[model samples]
Target: MTLNSGCRAEGKTILVTGASAGIGYFVAEQLAAEGADVALGCRDAAKADLAIQAIRVRVPAARLRSVRLDLADLSSLPATVDALDVERLDAVVLNAGILLSGPERRVNAQGHELMFATNHLGHFALVAHLAPMLAAAAHSRVITVGSFAARSELLDLDDLQSARDYRPKRTYGRSKLAQMLFGFELDRRLRARGADTASIIAHPGGALDSLTPSRPPLFVRTTAQRLRGLPAGVVLHGKHAGAQSIVRAILDTESTGGQLWGPRVFGLRGRPRRETPHAHMTDLEAADRLWAASVALTGVDPLVRPATPLRK
Candidate 1:
């Protein structure tokens, strides 16, 4: 199918995290197919190579490469951010995340909650480090993948790190809220500085693996999932459908920063459309607080110049 005008990504250089599979993979593939130079971010080089190879088969002329990125580890971030060869970044899709089904609280290498670290803090660091490069490009955008969980519960500012009260579902919900908070606040800051970059949050509702495209062998669903059916949202949709909202956030020139895009019908399944976020998603006060905390934790200021030189 042909991409709509607002969804076209030709002549752009884009980076998609968690692109080894799932929503991220589809987003990267679609961007490449539309003539964007796509960079796939994966923790493992081999897996990245394979994903890019697969994309090339679908679009032989695709400009695709792999960039090593470990969201759960901060030490690896500096090198990864400095190593990106692209002088301009038209868009950055922060789509990598994890949902822990086990009833246990896990921490990352930094001793922070794993889901929160991977889903929010990791993207925060990446955006901070890449801000300079992004600002260099006209009308660049950072598309952060949020989730339905954000609207379900409010994050505890007193315990943003989940130190005392840590529950898997609550942590996941908080992570998504953090993403929205960061994205919104980043937009406000960029606007204040008159930077052309835009920060947009996109949520994909109920895109289950059963309805999604075929996965890499290792990520395929279990027998139970196939037999009982994948858990869906208010409506069941495929990964490709979910990716439309993300693509729109990146490509829609008319969409201003700080807007949340998601499924139109009950946020379950439908074409992407602008939707009012939970009251807290646009709370600038909370955003400021989150920004301060993120800066302290990540040690990378969004407006500061990169510590290292950019090399291609």
Candidate 2:
């Protein structure tokens, strides 16, 4: 599929969460190269600075800044976004996420599951707080970064927190699935109201840190690491390649809302292309349930309109 780049991001200000490392870092780097003002949304100021420095090294005049954002804490979102101090945002890449390693289920300060909190709820609230800034732009986009792992999982609305059953991979997949659902649902809501913003979902397919190129202090792939990952190159790609889906979602003017974009090869490792979301990911009823649950958990409704009451 030939991707269109008609919507150049030059002169636009974009906010990218989790921009401190991995795929997020590369997304910020690529956007900077395109002449867009890239704001690195990170929980750690120091790390964001390193990412900015790294990008500047590559793109000498890279326009970048750090915005304090911690997706783990719901209460911090409003203040975090307010700190941006920008009247308009051309796009927002909700790419920050955490994958728990141990078998135990982790929870954030607010007691919600850690992965679910950061991966889904945090982004949900962040979008709510930034709705006005997004609407302020003549045309804006909210690109939610999901995972290919979501294809195998289903959200248990009752067990969203994984309180009932918690296996590391399952929980992580469900969290990502919830995020994708919100992305699709947000698109529906935006279109239903004829809003200026568009919501799109993009997944990094199968990105391996070892396969990724070095970005210095933020990411360093030793020669050994690169060699170790060479074999997996047949089906996996580096974070830089993984970031293409996000870049396309943000800049492809022809790409409409609710479309899923990922790698072209078996949705794993290749150039970015439009892909079909799993059946469960497109269930409207489940999407609505997840939406209500998110609002109840975060107390922030996205795209609030007086005429249309919040969905229950």
Candidate 3:
């Protein structure tokens, strides 16, 4: 769905991570078309440049910039925030991510498992670092892209890094679950702090598709994907339809501060719809535990106590 010229993002400054390709690229372009000053974040400088060029070509007057951001590396986040001047962000979309197909475990520079680090921890640190800026924007929002797979997975804090038993698919599911939990917890914290910022979550359903398949072996992956069916986007599903929901969440002033929006059909592919939080995911004890663990793992805290709490 196309955003009307009267869309609220006009004149807003927004940053979208992983804007080099796929849904991220389209989101950046759409935002630009709506008159948002956009910053496209990608791990590769060349890819980011190409995305920026493409957006400008699509909208000659598009206000867009490019920056380097490798979500696997926490150290790279500071530079990325500096490049975009986080203080000016009206919204920050965490869209960049990776999916693994095999059982081979990978570790990021920070020693966190690859899927968890990139999908959850990296974005965790990015938001934490930019929390002050988000707070400064008054009604600013932090939108995180999560997946419906989260509902099927259970949070195992003991194995959060996937150090004990490792399965690529399960690891990815856990990471997405962590993201959803974080979004919920962040909203609560923001409210407690009396900040106007909102924390929102979205999923692409299953619309992702490409003519060019992965290089390794198309047949194997294709078969696996086909067997996975709707969830994997092998068939028509709500992925892109969910994108519209994300757009709505970002622009709709009536939306509640913490909500999960996705496709309404089969929970996979369909138009965006408001979803009830998974009962397992809403536990305050779990949220608190995950928040504490994340703070220790990422070494970034959204809530930092001052030297003293001033008396009322």
Candidate 4:
């Protein structure tokens, strides 16, 4: 279902990362169509232009701009924030991510494991840099896109950088789990600072169909799709149904500060609905550890006070 133009984001300014394609692209497009000024954050300037051009073609009046953002590079984050001229942001969507199968562990220039660096750490830095703008907005929201895979993983603070061992899929799951933990921790921290910003999490539930050669093997990815559904595609079990969940989370007033919204059907394919928090994700101690490591790794602290203490 398409989001109504009269929704909460109307007249607000939002920045969507990894908007060159997939759910990020759709989220930006939907937000723009609803009368929001959107900043499309992408790694490639040319691709970002193309994506913005596509959006303009469909919505000629769309108030959209493009910025270069590479989630793998922690240093590039501050520049991205500076490029956004607006003093405050109504919402920031940390949507850019990577899913790869590596035969051996790989590290980025920052000396971080490729999967964790790109998926979790990058976003961690971006949010910290944008924290001031978020706080300035006061009551603004931060919607992070996460996955169901986080349920199977636990945060290993001792090896957050993946120095000891690494399995591509498992590493990816760990990063996602970290993402959710950070989101929840952000909400708790905001409360401690008496800031009104809300941190919410949403998952697309695997309906994405677009592919690149570097992605997972055809049979494995395709099997996941078939098991999910046809019209929804393999990535999404139901056709664009995952989009509704995101839209609802972004606009739903009833949603609390740290809620997880998933699709309604099996594999989270249908309409949007509130889901129970993953058992592993409820560990506040892990969340606090992940937050501390994220701050040290990114060196961007937008919080006014120290992070909230985790429960035992």
Candidate 5:
């Protein structure tokens, strides 16, 4: 509850999941400072409160709210949507995800691979649940945060879930690939339906906490990370820098549905600009397969199910 006094986003409302920390937090904070009413979607109440408090400190009159969204639990997502008081959402940034701590593959309660579950499937369900709000808005955008790994040669559709074969880097990259596939297909579907919303993609180049001026305690510095601190300054950009692409993807007036924006310089460190996604991510057949798999697994369809009328 605050006044958006002279910012471009004065009357807009946006939902940023995984906004409790890291790049998500940076994006949410920036949006709030710019006068957008931001719904910080997070599972941890403490972190959420901290994030809100931090933004208020900066913006002084920032409008902010919270919604509990745990990507690991599909059951909690729809309820999360129901709790949002906003009648329409101008943007929804699907930014929350996990880089698994170990090489051993883990699974969520629904049994999807941990990275894929949290990053792709969870976001898949969330976007579907929020579609109504998006439709209600005069214009809306759905921006997904992707990674450089999405361009790697690690994607293997034969074992998309990585049940039989799992490599940490490859699995993470594939999940990003899945996200892009969904994003592209989503734009195609939304356009076919003549929807006013746009589905856009953006990725932070090589952003890490180490490069941040504030250097918040987001992660413990490994010995190797410490050794490269000097090089990190040149190679790594801060979270704030990373957030530029997300902000542009969400608010850039010139952008269109299915367009992608990323770092200008080889994806390591630079300003945000429109860029093409990898060939693997642009595959329509793969997008269709991933979309079907996501629907079957999450039990939430982004298409027909969202428009179905509720019954008492």
Candidate 6:
């Protein structure tokens, strides 16, 4: 299950968004244990501090810092990048997302559907802004955390905002599909431009909180909850196991651009493995259309030219 045990990232710096809890938290913990300088990108300053403290409990020598990143507010992405202030980034894990549970559709500050905007547009913008930092590294990676849920959903590029028919779960799946399309398209553009950065997609199979190990303030599962979720846990898995795909994508030297990685057992549970993405996910035309729409909406074209060097 722990594929990266032999991998050492001593001199590398990686950023993980939504590290405050769940799969992101576990991914950061594993990376820190591998000696990577980890930047926890979170929306809440307080939660970020708690996650750092919790991670340090497990990794006393972890090199950890926090970046205030609110994906819902696209206007703040530039400032978030400025706050990072790192000369080069070894990798970035686009793991943060909003999983809407309510039937009612929500919208972010930009007036876009909440799930689509936060899960897709926000990450698209964030990566574009961080393109230079990624480019600065001799070799870098962008790990897009997608979902098995997206396998059954179709991305309506026309209704990206989900204005006409917005069911909660469907909207969330479509949003993730959009994000995956962007990740694949990004790799295509990077290769075309001869950039050194690689983009890979990773999806946590089926992660449940109750099956996840406790980290005190950040995440704690009640004994009753554990018992209740035991059946599903046996079949599915926890966030800890779920995070392995992302970790492998970042640390696995064999990993290449445009590859899809996920759990080994039917793409549902087990260790990390590279698998063929669903046919729909590989549609180049659909990916290209999503790319153009994303550029129009975010106003940032990544890898278009050499990035300005960051101040040390």
TM-score of each predicted structure versus truth: 0.91, 0.95, 0.86, 0.87, 0.90, 0.95
Tens digits of per-residue lDDT for model 3, 1-312? 654345567768888888887668767877887778888888988878777777776688999988888889887777777777656578888888898997799998878899998988888888876766776775888888887678899989778988989999989999988888888888899889888889998777665543212222111136555455545454445223445667766776656678988767765666667888788766788888999988788777766622221111
Taking the tens digit of each residue's C-alpha lDDT, what string does model 4 give over 261-290? 888765467778888887677678888778
Specify the poorest-scoring 10-residue window by lDDT in model 3. Answer: 211-220
Clashes of each: 0, 0, 4, 9, 0, 0
For candidate 1, lDDT tens digit of each residue in 1-312? 344576677789999999988889888888888889998889988888878877777788999888999988866777886677878899999999888978778888777888888899889988878887898898999998998888887878889978898888888999989998888888888899988998898988778777765544425566666555555534668787888888877887767898989877888688888988888888878888888888777777777865743221
lDDT of 6 by residue, 210-303 (tens): 7888998788889998898899966799999999999999998889999999999888888899999888887899988888887666666665
CA error at residue 297 for candidate 5, angstroms: 0.9
Give candidate 6's root-mean-square deviation (CA, Å).
3.2
**Cα distance off (Å), candidate 1, residue 251:** 1.1
**Error at 169, model 5, angstroms:** 1.9
Candidate 1 Cα RMSD (Å): 3.3
lDDT of each: 0.82, 0.89, 0.75, 0.76, 0.82, 0.88
TM-score of 4: 0.87
Q: What would the per-residue lDDT of candidate 5 be over residues 1-312, giving only the tens digit for each residue? A: 122233268789999999988899989988886778999999998888888887877788999999998988877776889888777999999999888758788988877788998899899988888888888887799998888878875456678889998888788888988888888889999999999989999898888766654422333456565556657767667778889888877776777889888877887777888897777777888888788878878877776555542211
Ranking by TM-score: 2, 6, 1, 5, 4, 3
Candidate with the larger lDDT of 1 and 5: 1
| Strongest candidate by lDDT | 2
Error of 6 at 182 (Å): 1.0
- Which residue ranges in model 5 land beyond 4 Å of their true spot? 1-7, 215-228, 306-312
Q: Give residue 87's lDDT in candidate 4 (0 to 100).
A: 83
- The C-alpha stretches of model 6 lying farther than 4 A from their native spots are 4-6, 305-312
lDDT of 5 at 202: 89
